[model samples]
Target chain A: MRRIMTGPNVVLWLFMIVALLTGCRGGAPLTSWPGLTVAEGIVYVAAGAKVYALEADTGNQKWEFPGEEKKGPFYATPGVEEGLVFVGSNDNNLYALDAVTGNQRWSFATQKPIIAGPAVAGDTVYVASADSKVYALEAATGVGRWEFTTGNWIWATPLVADDKVYVGSMDHKMYCLDAESGQERWEFEAGGGIAATPTLAGDLLYFGAYDGKVYALDAASGQKKWEFQSGGWVWSQPLVVGDTVYVGSMDKMVYALDATSGQKKWEFATEGAVLAGPAFADDLLYVASEDKQLYAVDAATGQKRWWFTAQTSIFAPPALADGVVYTCSQDGRVYALNAGNGNQRWVFPRTEQ
Target chain B: MSQVWNLLLQGMVNSLLFLYDVLAHNFALSIAVFTVLVRLLTLPFTLPAQRSAKAQQELQPEIEKIRKKYAKDKEKQTQETMKLYKEKGINPAMGCLPMFLQLPIMFAFYQSIVKALANTPLQMVSLGKFASPSLSQLVPLGSHFLWLDLGYPDPLYILPILVVATTWIQQKVATPPSTDSQAASMTQSMQITMPLMFGFITMSLASGLAVYFVISNLVGIAIQYFITGGGGLLPQRGKKGK
Candidate 1:
């Protein structure tokens, strides 16, 4: 029927059209792309040309910031601290967005692409560029604090803990730098490229290398605590919670190891590869796989608790908030599911542009 | 198995293979070949879409009159519209028949590309990890295009530019004339905005999608020429923009 377009109706219609376009039969943009980041009380998702700030607890959209239509196809998850969100773009720049207003604060230009998301600590924001440079910028003004050089590209997110910043390099080295001065404290050579970030717990640091080992190093001295080997390369970041460290190997197995000793705890196998980091919430560890499964495993047992199979493989990590797990599939579907049961809550369809 | 179901399944498989073998391996060739194949596969609906689009365009004046007459009467307007469509042997759905029919094919295409090129494993065809001599024995799954990986956007941004240019050409050629002023305005805006938006996306995320878009647009142009003797269903002007 040809309905009369009232003000509310017009708004509804616009929403419906957007809903239709978003719910089109092709690929859902929000869930298909990897721009989901959770910080403070907001969950920021970069979909198409907009960045949406959603209430983390309620799963409701709070605000949507209209971004440049021709400049940024933003995939970097926003890093938030002190009322500001820092993110990178394919435009070869890092943007500091107001955490509340979603307004652009200031942007820093980079030499090449900034694929990895920005990481913030205290007054400085650390960003890894595809151009093989790790930059530390002043969080307030987007001014450069320091830029550290690496041999090859730096796509891994830089993690800062205990006054040290850890980053992996395509140059086959894991460089530990002093967070304040940006001086290389130590660099460990790997058999292959180190493309994943290191995780810190207590005095121990956990990270993966192309050498196929999940290495445990002392955060203070960079001394090797232990190294646990896997069959294939380790691309996914390692997660350390309590006494266990969880990581996925290109060998198609998710391995759980002792965080302090790097001894194998238990392993769970899947059909495909896992490139995204695992999220630990409650007693469950949630991981997205190229096998199209979001597996929730017992954090202590390393056994699969429940698995939700998506129509397409998920290369991006699944974000968990409230009681729901959010993830995207190559099938172009963004799904919200009950974290405990692995039952589908809602499926947003994909639309073709 | 049901006849329609079989067709859908086979169509999905065919699209997957063609996208990998033809599109990624040899893009231009794949686009041309697949466009024709797709057109021919949906050949049954082409005539109907053409007939419907032409009918819809022709009925615009009459439809506008009816809309004006019953503009306030939502139910009456709908009934009148349906009645008119029924009386004229015009299927309003005809224009979308080919596209609707191609849904399975499109899904399959997305699946295959994301799996094969995006480096996801769920839809992986398992092309048996081949050791490439150049890049340290890595199992290259045919996702690489020149120096940039199709799965991720290139830092240099050469592919995204090509994507925008080709997309603009395709949009300029394929967009149909709109009788409704609002629709026309929206269409115009979309034609300009979509390419720019997608160009940014390609620049940001995956260049492979841009490759797919470029090939798809070129193929679409070819399909239009082959089937409708011009630029698909859209009227061919002297130059694209006008």
Candidate 2:
């Protein structure tokens, strides 16, 4: 070893070659943005491997799931119904936990990662998975009631309303399934893959697809009523109120469109992709963007009212409760801000002193 | 610096997406086509490097002798090596130049595969940023090909095996016979170790990348065979193509 050159010159050459090979991010993120929701004064957010139940007002950790053993990087926004918290894990299991204690109630296994949040309707849990299947399970026991297969990955949360389940798949189709039997009622082919949960208002079903279009279809018949083009993929569920729908797009813009006509009302630009849905409360819409900012925009005008910058990008929609807005940043921290002034209330895992 | 790098990445992502569209939306096929296209485009530089490496390997025995002859004089050994290289029209530095040029492309291709697959939310968003508006519909180029999802590692371990085999064949063909016992020993270990390492890595890597490696290696083997006049895989270094 001593016979060969062993000095700064050799080190310099090695460093130069290494510098050349690196800099490309060669792998996808193993985990994704924190998915959170506010229900019953508790903010339940799934990030990395655990789901944390936090105080909506103080950002205080109430309890974290799987207290000791690590099993997942859960990214699905949790659903709370009948005292059970339903959240899906990257480990391909949907765990139903006791909402108060974070104790595991039961878990249902899927063939692949469950990225979409589970929808709890009455006594049934409807969850879509990346395995290209939708499962209907008993809410209390996690028993499989029925399963429906699709042509491709299902990333959108199942929309359950009036005994009908609407799910979107990366197969570029939106499906309507009977709630009890998991039988296909109808499916409408879209120009691209659908990732956002379909929004239902009146007789129309609204969704955004990867083809940069927002579609309105007759829910009962799966008939395409109209399609509105956006600048990029629409991954966020449309927020429908009155006759207008607000949706976000990967083109770094949030759109306001007429719910029935599919005509654009106005568009507000962001510095980065809008991956998550927007929330409306008190005439203000809270939209999260990859731009590392949670923007509070005037609902009627589509103009920014105020914004609060986080430590990193945001891809999870804000959960609004009692004038307090909760957002999960990609950095795995949750922030509570005043809905009126956009003033920071608190942040989880408080910054190091 | 990042902006320029991102532009290049976007260009690579777009090309892969375009090929996917034209190639029946088969992601695996598009990756193969993309690999071949890249190899073809870089052939001018890469071919010479391969030829130069092969030429240098064939010239190794003679160079070893010269080194031993001038073992006491470092400057004399270097001078003799240079003289021999020049006489044979082999530029020692040409090999390094092309490899240095290629590292970025190889890494960028890897990044593109990960971005184009879009198996996860974060990955999908990144892919969206780079894709042209016209290719938005292709946001998630099909990941399924036969039994393998190009976005995930092959479950049957077939692609990884192919990766190891092809890489070994290329390394074996490209390595020149060496006169020095220590040098030949290092070459032997390297020929075995490099392919194995790649295979082990491939077992966990996205099958799409494993597909890229296999295709890239097969092309490399063909070009290497043509360049070195069919250097057999098992031949000893000092006697190869002699």
Candidate 3:
């Protein structure tokens, strides 16, 4: 049956209302998480606009904390602990939400967008903001503990170790700040901005720079321990598993190096850039590539174990937990696969609203 | 270098850099200012676009008549359509000329941001030649306005909201009335879906581009109002000095 109103008039009216409504409610949803972190039995994921926590075993939604005022999309990974979830938003506010209820706990306002994930140590939560500052906040109260201003934007997650916090900034400086005071302990200059998350293992700290060098520095002194060269920029965080440091580079190579000496163990070449950090579980290293393929490589030999093809780019690191591996594709799909066989278990289409 | 290509590339670069710099400092305020600047700069083209749109609107009756006259004949229909357009001194494509012209500038803007804000070493290799080490140390290419980074996805989503609001207002003010049933219906569908679609897109993509679009649309409306009449929606002035 034809409706009472047909043709363009009806369409036009409908469109007008939709436009008006959408215009009035023009809020973006944070749909993608820069990284995923799991603690206790809860899994934390950051998408484009919000942070979500699910039961690690059930994939059941436990809670979701919406961002603060116009802080629409948050690519930063959420750091979770003790019923508190810490994440940053484009709204330039660092938010602390009740991990179980998804309620606002308290928020620390920043001068710029907080794209980098927050890292926690003791009572302090360290976050880097686009305003070229690394902030340390009281983990419980969301109170500003201290802030250290850098020469440029700080996009790297702050790595807290010993009594110091390490972060790389767009200012091309690798900074070691006094965790208690937020004062610069020392800063070593790189050729370009440090966008990679710093990795800590024993006495040395490792990070990739946009300047094409992977520099290892003494954790205490900030002195250059060793520098490894890649064909392109290394944006992925160095993952330390046992004695090996695993990282992927924009140069399209995933390198495995000895954690102590920074010596090359093995390298695997891919067709596309590797922006996602490598995930290690058991003896297999799982990595996602922009080439639309997820590869499972043998940790010891760097030999390909299994390869799964996706329709779009896979820049998000796969979450390996229990017996399942979770990964997201650019086509807006989240896939859960069997960790042992790399077989598909379930797929969740992205909700575009 | 073709004039269109050059305008598209250079204008886009200029627009992107200018917008980035402005929004980097203050998203809401910079977008407001950028809108004004863009509309003002293209104010001269507004009349031509308006006249062309008006001319087509006026010739709609005649075009409809032609369509009816040749309703059944596909070849003659095409020929008559051209004849009507040519005789009336109207270019059907003129209605989209400004938008088309704006394409290059849009692309250049996108390229500039991706380049300027990129943190990868590969992006840096290219940076050494284009990026002044002195400025590189100072400018992170990430814009800080209030709390959001114009370079990254907005956390609070304030910019996306503003973007949708401004775009919807612009769309409402600019949507032309249609006399044809099919065209009218299509227009209505487009009007409704386009803004919402754009709003969602802005929500998902980089906040920087959304800021540019919002500012550009608002600016376009203001320029049209001043150059034409108080409504800023239609061209009140016709070719006088021409």
Candidate 4:
């Protein structure tokens, strides 16, 4: 007694396979690292559909934006300035919320999703969007001042300093622009797309690219100073402290390099890729990895002093304010810990006790 | 079990990226080439089933005659059918094996396209983890190709039309006409519905996946033509020429 697949069986089986292939592939709304920012005893985080403002110490909810969940998810760390907090949404709009009340002051819409945080200097908010354009908006009114189009997506948050705006695009180029008029001053082409924001120290600019290379360039002239190759895509913004530059790589190694020479000093291994930039205070560098661990590596020796494991991956860079290191998990929970130890002080979006 | 599936996914992602890098960084070309390679690679599974189906189809008239002969006895009809299958060396179960083997590969290929395009941050992270380190620079492959952004849907609807047309053409050339009225009717309805259903899905899918469908169907049509001696598409034209 053997089974024979009739013609109807063949058609039915093909239909089932096609249904399984297409039906189960519903998109999950484009996830990345949760945007967590701690400032002035208030932690403003853009995770999921709402930006939550929690008390920096207790993790008690201060206020959530819009008083309702929005359609698009937000992952860009909110930029705090003046009395307003600026954050970008996957909905293609950058919203300005009052720092204390979490009330939306205004929102300036871009043509595509916003993947990076907004940078505010003085009266203007500089935003880079997946639309491949960098926009300058009036901070108070959210009116577009001017926009500069890049050749590809701009996932790197714009860095504004000394009347100059530095930003990188997936076009494999970093451009320096006049902070006021959105006019390009100079652009330096890298070997791959830049996802990490440019870290400016004195006259030198440091950043990593998808090419798995860390680069140092003269901030003013857009000339390459030196480059050090990493094992994988350097998605982290290189943290420049004193004469040392610390960066994380998708290769699961964190390398510390000489700031001026771009030579590797030491490297520390992690269990998973380090997607977030390292945070520094005192003698320790707080780094988050996709291994679900927040590591406090010694600033000088590149040795892990302590680590605190979250329930899920921690891809967002930990932020520090008032001796507290704030970290986020992909599960939408935030952990506030003592900077000296990786001990959790409180967790947000509280679980029932 | 999940880990093995991930490794298979990793293989597809790396292969696609590797192809993209070597083929002048054109993602469209990478997808088409990858689809052909996958079809060819899986031919070991598919070819046997295809041959079995054709053989079964060819013996349909004999099977019908046997059924009429054993009309008085139900057990005799099944016995005769099994005997006939043995005599012809045709096992209908061969069709089931290919379905099981090819389903996973086809599903993985669909996922690889989405991962390669990486339109979202979560997708980007997953792709980065799955892609080979040597191909990191190609993780978020350029999606732009001739008025189409592979990460997004085709606004012009050109790829959808092409997908429907190629799928319909392949079905037309691949379906063997049958004297069994029930089987012929089911095959005929499937040819109409499947092409239109896939075309509708293509309207919203990443144009890159649509490109893969169009290419896969064309390759399928070619294989089917050779396997079934040009099936039905070219036979009518040949008769006209004669």
| Model 2: per-residue Cα lDDT over A185-254, one tens digit each | 9999998889999999999999999898999999989999999988888899999989999999988999
lDDT by residue (B81-153, candidate 3, tens digit) is: 7888898888766655654454444344444444444433333333332433223332345455667656556
Supply the TM-score for candidate 1. Answer: 0.56
Which 10 consecutive residues of model 1 chain A have the lowest summed lDDT? A1-10
How are the candidates ranked when ordered by TM-score, highest leading? 4, 2, 3, 1
Winner on lDDT between 1 and 4 is 4
Greater DockQ among 1 and 4 belongs to 4
User: lDDT tens string, model 2, B1-242?
Assistant: 89988988999999999999999999999999998988778787677676777677678779889988999999999999999999999987777677667666766777787788877777777788889878877766777899997877888999989988987787667665556678667767766776787787778777888888888888877776777754547555345468
Candidate number with the higher TM-score (3 or 4): 4
Each model's lDDT:
0.66, 0.84, 0.69, 0.84
Superior candidate under DockQ, 3 versus 4: 4
Kindly list the per-residue Cα lDDT of model 3 for residues A270-290, writing each as its tens digit: 898888789888899998998
Highest-TM-score candidate: 4
TM-score attained by model 3:
0.60
- lDDT of model 2, residue B163: 84
Evaluate candidate 1 and give its CAPRI docking class based on DockQ.
incorrect
Query: Per model, how many backbone clashes are there?
Result: 4, 4, 34, 1
Model 4 pairs in collision: A31-B122
lDDT of 1 by residue, B61-104 (tens): 88888899999998999899889999998867666655555555
**Cα deviation in Å at residue A90, candidate 4?**
0.7
